[model samples]
Target: ISLLQDEHELARIVADMPWSKIDVNGLREQETRIRRQIERIENDPELGQLQTELKQLNQQATAENRNQYQAEDDLDKAQHAVQAEQAWLDAYGNDDFDDATLSSMVSNLLADAYENCFGASVRAQDRPKLIAGLFDHESETPFHTRALRNIVRIARTRIQEIDARSNQLRADTERIMDDYLNNHSTDDNTVMASVEDYRYFLDELDELNMLVTRAATDEEYANSVKKLYMSFQQLNRALRTDEENIKEQLNRINSMLKGQQFGPQGGRLSLDVTFSPIDRQFETTLSRILSKLEDWTRNASDNPTETRNAFNNCETFVNRLHNELDKIHDTNGIKAYGARNLDPRVRSSFYAIVHHDNAPDERISSTGGKSGGALQELTSFVYGAALIYLLGGDLTARPTYTTLFLDEALIKADGRYTKRALAVLPRLGFQIIVSAPESKTAEILNVANRAYVAYKDPSTDNSYLQELDSETITQDETQPTTAPAKPTTEA
Candidate 1:
């Protein structure tokens, strides 16, 4: 019984990793793949449905062999699950359970767990520590009433510590190597100093790992490992925060760009930006500016003529700054955005115009509503284009940005226009990071060397943005949205 209990617990633990990472899609995909791989029994396939059934039966037979030993630990946990399920089922069915029936049900469930989980399933016998897993039993032994739980735990605990140490050693090696490469210089002394520093950090990490692995007991190892884990958390936080000010600076520049006054009531291509974070939902103020610009472009008669000149002059300076900043960073990641410049669509064609037409807004005009929706589209386009144009161009460049992001970029465009607009991106230039979600196409994934998915946690008012890789990259920041006041009455 104790041995069977141990097997149940092991089986339960074995399932932990795959479950945490695999969601519905992954599971469904795996199931489908298995289904395809298994040929019908009628086909005389090498690995068919019959083969699967055979393996399952083999497992059942082995489990039955262990049943005579009465592995109590596994049986207990299995009994617990079975009892819980039975209680629910009985209640639903308006039935009552007797002791014999209950015991039989528990035993049957235990047998199933033994068969399915390779007889290593955790069971109710491990409830001693309440390990949170389904098969965790309260006591160690169920096979024949020996205190086997402690003995196995002691062994597992030691093994876990050693595993941690080995992983830490690998991390140290990578960190040391990355540091050595990053700090490598043309000067011999500088290179040697960097190499020495890298080596020192590696030695420090290795020593700590060794200490953890060599600790006298699992408890000692756990305590020591907590300190190491905390240290790692600190390092990861530091790395994430290090030199992130560049994005903030860019945001500020964007704010200034947003502040640039386009045409007033009646102008050609007026652009007043409403600056918001990449995750911000809408730029209300910017929307109004876009509305006004659109109106002016479309209603030139209503706009102030002087307003058009001021807007033009402001844009000239804005374009120059944008170009200069573009020089500082490689916007290769969003190359697709700017790819097909002379596209037939008005939006794409006009956006291409912004790329080369850096003149002040006075020369550009929407007199008598001739400018059309060009003003609004160009406003979003320039910012979007600037982002696309500035992403690190060399997909292979180390230390380059791993992601590119923009929020609510396609605010007002219709489906056809948006589709046409997005098509231009792949042709633009480079793709180093993975930030933007292109329309309906995972095809982009094929070309991307890497991709990132970012989102805020839903549990709190304070937005905690987390990346898919389990790293907290930024603070709890709210996505910017269009202020309620801005109205785009396009009647």
Candidate 2:
């Protein structure tokens, strides 16, 4: 059992051994065969030659191993060079160089470098030689890299200078803007800094400059003065003519009023027009300018001293006239300066004067002291005379029938005054139509040849008119005695 136990341990140890399954008899037979072959080779006569050949073959195998290693290393270096060249091409090559030749690629690179360094493109022929010189150590201009560095340095210096100048300009602009805003600040602390405000200021400056230039010479100033003087003369003549026309019309109206008889005393009426200057200073200056202009015209060529004095006087008067005009706030005053007489500066007052054969002359303007009937009679004569003045044309010619319509007129007048007032219009060739209330119907009809009654329908809220014969009316009848069934015409 002990031997069997040891034998089992040995079998287990053999199973664990690395080479426990070796064929020992085959190994011994291979060792005997190898020694027998070696002995036979050493003893044979061709052994030396065979040994020499074997040694030579071993040397050849060693050389071939060394050559294989060198070739592998060279191939790795070539691969690395190819990868590096491909990366360089990716960095610098353009799509334009996709099918280009190697010479073209080198020329393009040189051209790009030259343009970048010198800020200009080189010719194609110059590119190759420049590229060759960049890489050639023997060339005099081999400092292309230094030149590029210098260009970069110059660009940086210029950029810094531009930045400094820009900052200075910005500071100056801000300072100027602040100063302008401060100077032009308004009462509300607002600045008129808009482009339009600046433009308007510039325009005003230009106009002032133009005026200054225009009057810089004495001859130019004289010419301007002459123009202004002539304008003033023309305007004065126009205004005087307008004033004469107005006076003539007033005279014609006065003539018509003189023929009319008013009240029981047969009073005559007249309109009085008075002239007064709106601006006394402006008129005085204008008159002085006119006198100076006349003097200048009369003695300008004859006497130099008189011409100069006249011109100076005219200029002074013109300046005063301009100042006075500036002070004038009336629209008519300004229009008069432009020769447009919308409102004549002369103020006119109309007065109805009564010329009675028995009593002293009285002015109708004092209506506060007069009776309402007397005032009404006087106004009616004045109005009838004004109508005749407008429509009578020539007073000497025979009159034509012109209709005058009066609504509720002469109601405050007594019967005698109302009759006289109503007769005044018909005598002036006016056919009068009087519309009065029922209370004044008797007074109105005393002189009316025809009358009309206005009636309103309560249901329809419409008004209508009915004509009446004057013979049918009586002093006792206030309302219409009869009205037509339907309206003669709508009112």
Candidate 3:
């Protein structure tokens, strides 16, 4: 009864447990199977090998974790170092700092520091040492400070040389200024010496330079004036030569007309040439200018006062010429002097003067009030004379043979006037060839050396020339001479 009570208590405890609902048999079986697996693992050879490999892999993992930690620490340290260097560079770098500029700044700073550190004992060899000491913590290599020392020394030497040269120049400038003041001391031009300051000395030097330049310019102007004066002299000589030639030509023409008599009253003809009143004035002024220019050139180098006076006179004449030219409306004015105004035909008035025994002297201009017959006779004389002048070998001697063509000449003249006209050209040394109609043929044949009659053939339309006998047209011997009536003048 005691054992039964114990069993009954146990059953009651089992029922009151939390896992009392579980199958106790199934749990026992799963535990048995897990036990069997654990036993197999303990006894297998490949399992022991896997365990050994796992042990080694864990050891390797531990070592790899330690190496990774070390690597991360090293990377952090390296990054900090790069950042420190970048920050340092940023402290000194600037946008304006190119390589040359930055190098100069660094050199100056190092030189100053070197000078402060060692003072007079700053040797070239010690420069690199100083550079290294200053920038030892920097990543870049130090500068070659020996070259810097040499540059500084050379710069200082050059500065001293410049100062010495400047002093010499100042002394030379003072000496030259004193010399100039002493030499150029004149009553009209007084040079003051105030060279105490360098700038004042430079100012005085500049003034002297300007004066020298002005003197040179004055010399050049004088040379130009000389050239202009020489040109005027040449022009004057040419004008004189042309005038002489014209006078000679007129003389020749007049000599040819001296003995030749024309018209019923036995009148003589002569040509006259003269410049207009304004042209004469311009010529006179030009002569005066030439004289003044001569005086100026003669005194230009030696006498300043005389040169100035002569130049002023020339200027006055030139101004007068300019004013006159401005007033002239005609292009044929004195401005055209050498070309057109000087031409005898353009500027001068021509008159055919007839001098007779009883009549007053009559001037026949271009618009003459004279009979055509009388004018034609006079024109023949003048034309003959001009031809003789143009045939320019020897004025006194006649040519061997020179032909003068008179086409229908003396057609308007009477028989006496025609005979006189025809006789004049032959006397002036011309072979006369006359072309006159049958009406005047008798008078023309009296003077013509040879004659030919031209006729055209109507059938063939061709022209033919035939010589005619001089005896065909004969002068009448019985024609009585009578005193010519007074030649009527045209209204």
lDDT of 1 by residue, 187-236 (tens): 44533333336667676776777777754543344333344334434533
The C-alpha stretches of model 2 lying farther than 4 A from their native spots are: 1-219, 232-247, 274-288, 298-315, 319-349, 397-401, 460-464, 470-491
lDDT of 3: 0.68
Q: How many clashing residue pairs, candidate 2?
A: 0
What is the TM-score (0 to 1) of candidate 2?
Answer: 0.44
Show the colliding residue pairs in model 2. Answer: none
Q: Against the true structure, what is every candidate's RMSD?
A: 40.6, 28.7, 31.3
Whole-model Cα lDDT of every candidate shown, in order: 0.43, 0.67, 0.68
On TM-score, the candidate that comes out on top is 2
Poorest lDDT segment (10 consecutive residues) of candidate 2: 337-346
TM-score of 3: 0.43
lDDT of model 1, residue 469: 26
lDDT of 3 by residue, 1-491 (tens): 99999999989988788885778899799999999999998999999999999999999999999999999997985666566556545754454534565567556755565465444766766544444444345574434355456556756765788899988987788788778867876765444454456576576786677667835445445655676677667756765566557667788889888878867777787876665443666678788788777666565556656555555566765665457455435564534433343344344566767788788987777745766677777778888898787784667766678987777766787777788888888888888877777677677667666777776655566766667673532322333466443222110
